[model samples]
Target chain A: MSHNTFPHADHDPRAVRLAARDGTLVGPTAGLAKGFVQVNLVILPEAQANGFLRFCQSNPKPCPLLAVSEPGERGCAALADDLDIARDVPAYCLYRDGRLDQTVHDVSDVWRDDLVTFALGCSFTFEHALIQDGLPVRHIDEGRNVPMYRTSVPLVPAGGFAGHLVVSMRPYRASDAIRAIQITTRFPQTHGAPVHLGDPALIGITDLHSPDYGDAVSMGDDELPVFWACGVTPQQVLMDAGIAFAITHSPGHMLITDIPDSRVALL
Target chain B: MSHNTFPHADHDPRAVRLAARDGTLVGPTAGLAKGFVQVNLVILPEAQANGFLRFCQSNPKPCPLLAVSEPGERGCAALADDLDIARDVPAYCLYRDGRLDQTVHDVSDVWRDDLVTFALGCSFTFEHALIQDGLPVRHIDEGRNVPMYRTSVPLVPAGGFAGHLVVSMRPYRASDAIRAIQITTRFPQTHGAPVHLGDPALIGITDLHSPDYGDAVSMGDDELPVFWACGVTPQQVLMDAGIAFAITHSPGHMLITDIPDSRVALL
Candidate 1:
């Protein structure tokens, strides 16, 4: 997302959260509170939280954990001040028996005492770094969602959770691809460096134009389709595992946390 | 080169240098003193030394300077305890008006009082790091010299020094290529990260199989040709500029230094 998308967006994470809580700002969170850390939300029942946490730990590239909320608790104090897990996200996805049930603005009405909230690192952090470093992110330039593919590359299975890896693709020329690798390597929390580059078929991605998820962006003949582990992988894994109930932030509608993006950089 | 090529090679840099000085090691210095820094040598008259140094500074990726000796000095104490500019290399190349004059085991006889010695970082250091990290070096595996090419990419000129950039190619699968980039980035003293990968034509290299220097190693269908600025760049630049007199270590016959490879790593 670019500054043009959020010309009057609040610069404070608290303001963004308050807007979400009041049902006043109900759209994608991209470019809002620009320097703050935005995260992917996943809420599961207490019975499945441990297994899901193990899954995230095992597959860090796709599901790098930022913070975990206590069972039945709404406040994630580590992420932000006055944060409410049930209402702070711009939009939420409620799932039932491996299927998406509904997309809602708030989940307070459906909040459960047995639920546990998880915050996973999002690629927005590294994309911001890339743009700042004068690297072009094709999707951002094309005003489309980053194209994502479900690859045959399997994730290390953790108790009751198993699925193929899902990756987000961004096209870059060879030199820029190398620079992107160096820049993203400093942000391990945000997927680190690319998993595969040059060949899509090598990673079991059959078609470049037809992504399994997100909008496909244009690629130049000189560009290579670079793939990184995506946050969507966890939602797919939840569906594959046939979980009874779960909630995730709707695509592009992430949770804006008080943490600065720089704080999450490994370097 | 592999370990078998140096069945009884000395592990100590000092011992390797002693062997070179005693005329017992009159060949390529690969696989000797394995963990130490091996440098490319260049000795020129004092008249052209400053301009040559500026050229190196301007084009660091190609001519990463390790140490420079004062005019007429025959020793560089920073590189090793007893390093001699005229005799430590396994073989020396004497050039007159940029043309090959002779190849000799030592340059002590012709070494002038007005000569200045320049020691440049070589690719061997990072190659060692790559091998230690379990990545394959194709040329080393095939027992062939790393392929070197003259690219259309030009060097930043200094005074009378100007020429196209020279690059060394190593083929690797995409994942291994990413890992090699990371591994090599730590050794800036070496050539650091790759300059380009994927297309040779973009860099004005029309053919990969027919390199201008060194043996052409085999590339697999699964691999991408990763290129790094080569030490031979200065030698090529020197030839293009037509310097009156100069001395360089023969190809693959490097000057072993006391500095450990790990010691040169930035990280």
Candidate 2:
């Protein structure tokens, strides 16, 4: 299911966590833990935790749940033995009254006993699988960010987190697109599979080059644009919900964990 | 690996053989027996048998081999019991020097000890699978033939049998195309997944409406044409090779075998 193997695909989640905690790794977490999982971090008050959990359950593709910490808890033993959610991520985004407040390197100063942590699966795992299978991921090949767009496809409603879906795009020839579907289907905890492909208009995207988020990758002739659910959907949901105070990992900055990428594969 | 579940999918290969032998079924074998495998029949003299077998082995996508009879033997118990290659199929086409010699209901009148039987898997099983999964097969819904095209993608050469790949096309929306690919990949014996999709000109087909064989189906604006390696490729190969004497099942007149379609699924 998950073709997670890569050259020197070995990393110590504990070491990376320690580095983040010591304030030495304050940049993007990419290439830090190759075979381990990196997740999107979301911190909200215990009052809104149940609703957010339901939101993830209702829309698994975009918000595939890796782990959710208990109210005031800092560590999820299922992901790592000594994980600290507030200090483990490279960077955090503080949103006050549904508006961007400030980006910070550490959350220890603002940490609250009522804060709940959520770790949502990201596309880096499936992207690794696709690469192992020799499928060309256009954005990666072009040395740019994956093109992400807000789609009109509505998510199954959840308490206080209702919104449309966001998708990450990759262009491939017809046959490779098919193989990518099979490969991604095995990883249900990581956005399972694609929600749409080919025509962008059918999914309400008016322009391919004008992506709502991430850099737009060029499409070669005859290549079909395949789309997968993105973790950014949860961020969109949070903004739409107008939460009083919430925190999330800055884009490209993630929480590195001990969970092997292969552990999430269903098959 | 096989997903061989079907309610009342039981069918005796011997009974279908008996019916065809008695002329009780003189037309196409479509829907005569459900959940069982049906095969394209090919009969050639021992002199040409080796080359034909090699051809199928070389071009697995187009000519996936199911079973081959020993010289002077018509029974392949692996597929069915009491099978008669000369009379089992509903119809047969005898080719002479690459030309259509004659169409016959039964070849028992001209049966010879040197003639060898070769059975290849048909697409009926995969079509059944796709329909079971609720993917629309355009041809069946429209009451028309699935469009066929001769692609410039050349097949691997084996002995005197060599030619371009022939593909059977079905139009689908992008999401369905991804699902179709996953479904068909599990059935390698049934032409295992599609070879090409999207733009026809990329595969050397000049027009989608003008196919080399079978009737053309209409394509909607958002629908992409997905192509699978067709069973007709071996027939085309035989014609291209200009074999002196060869026999094949007439269109839609397949040999019903007791082997369950799920038996061919690779999971």
RMSD of every prediction: 2.3, 4.8
The residue pairs in collision within model 2 are none
Candidate 2, CAPRI quality class derived from DockQ: medium
The Cα error of candidate 1 at residue B265, in Å, is 1.0
Question: How well is each residue in A1-267 modelled by candidate 1, as lDDT tens digits?
Answer: 232454325569998888788877788888888888899999999899999999999999999999999999999888999989899887999999989999999999999999999999999999999999999998989899999999999999996799999999999999899999999999999899999999898889999999999998999988888899999999999998888899999999999999999999977
> Any idea how many clashes model 1 has?
0
**Which docking category, incorrect, acceptable, medium or high, applies to candidate 1?**
medium
Cα RMSD over interface residues, candidate 2: 1.7
Superposed by TM-score, candidate 1 places the C-alpha of residue A252 at a distance from the truth, in angstroms, of 0.5
Task: Report the number of the highest-TM-score candidate.
Answer: 1
lDDT tens digits, residue span A42-138, model 2: 8999899889999999999899998888889888887898888888877899999988799998998899999999899988888888898898888
Candidate 2, residue B96: Cα displacement in angstroms equals 1.1
